[model samples]
Target: MKNIGQRLLEERRRLGYSQQYLARAGGVSAHEQRQYEQGEDLPRADYLAQLAAHGVDVVYVVTGKRSTVINISRDQAQTLMDNRVVGQEVTLDGPPEEDLYFKLSDPSGPPPDQS
Candidate 1:
């Protein structure tokens, strides 16, 4: 398993954010930021909260795994954020939409009659 610092550094680089930028955004001294990324010291809870506020996934920070709950098509995601998605019940809190739409592609392709 990767260390916390390594994971944090990976996420930072993945977002194309510089250490200095993250430090400022996360409200920590540059030296502290370097240390955190170097495994010298762990950031306090408040600092972690700051990073999360800036869109850094706290689960990824601690467990190095993606645990985001939201999942939607890029277009749908934007639409939901824009307060749309009315009448899109499947996309809401319910069974997966795939269950409902799966038959459309095979409307006349169901199994042969068992007469």
Candidate 2:
């Protein structure tokens, strides 16, 4: 299984978001975002709040499990349509549903070390 860092990197890539773009959205420096993706540091609650606001799948990042919110690229959507895998072009309104936005924004960071 990939680590948190790898998942973070994957999410960023999936969204086609540059580190700088996420940095601005998350209110962190690019260096900090890099460090988080490098597993040198974990993201905090407030930082995640910003990410959730900007549509980062924070649940997948921290837990390694993806939420139901699937953000497909236009080409992929088109391909699905071409293959008849998807019936009817449904126009989605509003933001893609994110799982547990409340939870991701709750914990201040990784749980405090008990030991």
Which lDDT tens digits does candidate 2 get at residues 1-115? 8888888888889999999998888899999999989999988889887887777788888899877665565555556556764566654235444332112233466777899
Alpha-carbon local distance difference test for all models: 0.73, 0.76
- Candidate 1: regions farther than 4 A off: 71-115
In model 2, the Cα lDDT at residue 90 comes to 50
lDDT of 2: 0.76
Best by lDDT: 2
**Every model's TM-score:** 0.60, 0.58
Model 1 TM: 0.60
Q: What's the count of clashing pairs in each model shown?
A: 0, 0
- What does candidate 1's lDDT look like per residue over 21-110, in tens digits? 889988999999999999999978888888875667667889877754443555564455457555554333444442211112345687
Clashing pairs in 2: none
Q: Which residue pairs show backbone clashes in model 1?
A: none
The per-residue C-alpha lDDT of model 1 at residue 83 equals 71
